[model samples]
Target: MAARVPGPRPDEERSPLAVVLDVLGADEQRRTRIAWLYYVEGLTQAEIAELLGISRVKVVRDLQICRQTGLVQIQINGRLAPCVALERVLVQRYGLTQAVVVPSPHDPAHLPATLGVAVGAWLSEKIGPGQTLGIGWGRTLHWSVRALRRREIPDLTVVSLLGGIGRGSEINMYETASRVAETLGAQCYYLAAPAYASSASLRDMLLEQAGLREVLERARRADIAVVSVGSLGPESTNRRIGLLDEEELPGLEAAGAVGDLLCTFLDAAGHPVDHPLNRRAVGLPVEDLRRVPTSVLASGGPEKVPIVKAALIGGYVNTLITDERTAEALAAG
Candidate 1:
C-alpha cells in the first residue's frame, strides 16, 4: 500500500514519518543532510554549506526545515555543571542567594589573602553605585578589604557596623574599616567609642554620644551588611583581638552561644544566642544583621565548620564565601 502523505501542519493522527515527509517549506533531503551535518556533526553553518556547495543562508533554512520536519534533536550535556550545581544546592538548602567556595589555602596564613581577593572580586560585582555597605571589623574582613580594588562610587556610603578598637592583637578594627572606606572611595562613619565598655551602664551612656549613635543608626539603615563569623574557641580572633572578653564568655555560653557576629552570638541552630553583648556591644543586633540582606565570609578549615554552620542556620548570612574544604564540610552537613 502507498504510504499516506501528510499535511504541512500535522494533526493528531499523523505518523512521525508522514510528518517528516511533509514538505514544510524547503528541500527535505538536502535540508535533512544539512541539519545532520551542521547540528549532529557539530559543523558550522558556513562549513556545512561550503561542503555541500550551498549558501550559508540555504544551510540555515535547511536546518530550520529539518527541525520543522522533526529530523533535528539537540540536548544539553549537563545543567549547571558540577561546580554550579554545588553552588545551587548550597543556596537552596541554606536559603541563600549566592555562595562562593574558594580552594583551601595552601598555608593557613595565605588563606585569608587568597579568599579575600576572590571575595573582593565578588563584591566588585555585588555592589553598585548608590548603595550603603556596612562592614564589621576583624582580620578576615581586613583581608577581604585588602583584596578589593579601589573603585569610587560617589553615591556609595560605607560605615562601620560596630564600635572601634578595644585592646587586641588579631587585626586592627580601626585600620580595617578605614581601608575599606578608602578602597571604595565612600564616606566612613566610624563608631566613635570602644566596642565594649567597663559596664552596661557605661556602655549605655557611651551609646548616647552623638557620633556613636549616628553610626549605629546608619548601620541599621545599611542596605547590605558584611561580617565575619566568630567561633567560641579560646584562641578565637574575637577573643584574642579583644572583640570579646573573658568575662563575656560565660554569659555567651549560658546563652547557648557557639559563635558570634559583631559580638552577637548564635547557637548551634544558628539562632541568636543573646547575652551581655546585647547590653555592652554596640552595633546592629545579630537578628538585625539577619533581617538585612547580608553576606558572611569566614575562612578557617574544619575547626570553624560548626560555627559556620550555626551562622548559616541562624540567618546571619544569605551569602557565604568559604574555602573549598569548608564548603565540602558544609555539604557534608
Candidate 2:
C-alpha cells in the first residue's frame, strides 16, 4: 500500500502576494505587493509594512516604484472629455458661437453642480457693462448661480424671461436672477408674474403691463441668453415649477413635443411643437433666441439628451455645456 499522503504545509498555501511575487519576481515584487496591499486592501502604508514585515520606508519606496512602473494606472470614466470633443463636433455641425462640456460625476445628477461651475466661469468672463442678458431658469441654472465667481463689472442688466414666484425652494428664478445680478455687479429686472398664465390672452395681457413688457422687450434685445434645455417627465422643470399641468402635457405631446427650450417644446428634429402652449409662452421665441449672440449652457445626464439635442438642432443655442455621457450621445447621434 502507498504511504499515507500528507496535506500540504501552511506555507505551501498560495497567497495573492506570493502569486504576484512569482509573476513579477524579487526586484519588482516588493513594490508591486505594497501597492496592491495598500490600494486594493485599503491598508495604510504603516499597516502594510507591519503586515509584510518590512520597514515603513521600504513600503513607501515600493509604492513609488509601483507608480513609476505604471502599476498605478488611473482612467477617468465620464463625459467631460467627450463633451469637449462634442463641442468641436457641434461647432462644425451647427456653426455654434461657443460650446462648453462639463464632466458628469459618476452619478448623472451630480452633473448639474459641476456644470454650474463651468457656466459660471464662462459667464463671469463674458458678462459686463451695457450688455442686456436674458436668463431662463431651471435646476442647472440655479447651480450655475451658486458656482459663479463674483466680478466687479458694472452696468450689467439681468432680465428674466420667465416669472418664478411660487412656494418652491428659495433657489428659484428670482433668487438665481438676484444672485447673478449681484455677482456680476449688474441690475436685476424681475418679471413679477406666473411662469405660465391660464391662457394666451392672459399672458398677452400680463406682458402689456409696463414693468413686465419692459423686461420682456429687453430680453428680446439681449446679447446673451443663458438657457437650459428641459426634458419631459414629471420631475421636469416645467412640470415641477407648475408651468405645465398634467392636463396640458398630453396636448404638448400630441403637438410632437420631446422637450423644451425657454417654454417652447420641440420634436426630435428640433422643430417647435407648435401647440397652444407655444402661443402662450412669454419667453424669447426660438427665432429670436437663435438670432441673438447668446451663450447657451446645458448640462445634466442622459435624460437631458433629447432636449439638448433638439436645442442644438433648432439653432436656439450657439454654445452647449454638457457632460461625458451626453457628449457621447451627441457624437453617437
lDDT top scorer: 2
Q: On residues 149-249, what C-alpha lDDT tens digit does candidate 2 reach at each position? A: 66766667898877775676655767788878887788889888866666899988988899888887888889888988787876686677666777988
- Which 10 successive residues of model 1 have the least lDDT summed? 73-82
Q: lDDT of candidate 2?
A: 0.76
Root-mean-square deviation per candidate:
19.3, 16.1
TM-score of 1: 0.70
Task: Name the regions of candidate 1 deviating beyond 4 angstroms.
Answer: 1-83, 167-170, 247-251
Instruction: Quantify all predictions' global Cα lDDT against the true fold.
Output: 0.73, 0.76
Can you tell me which runs of candidate 2 are displaced by over 4 Å?
1-83
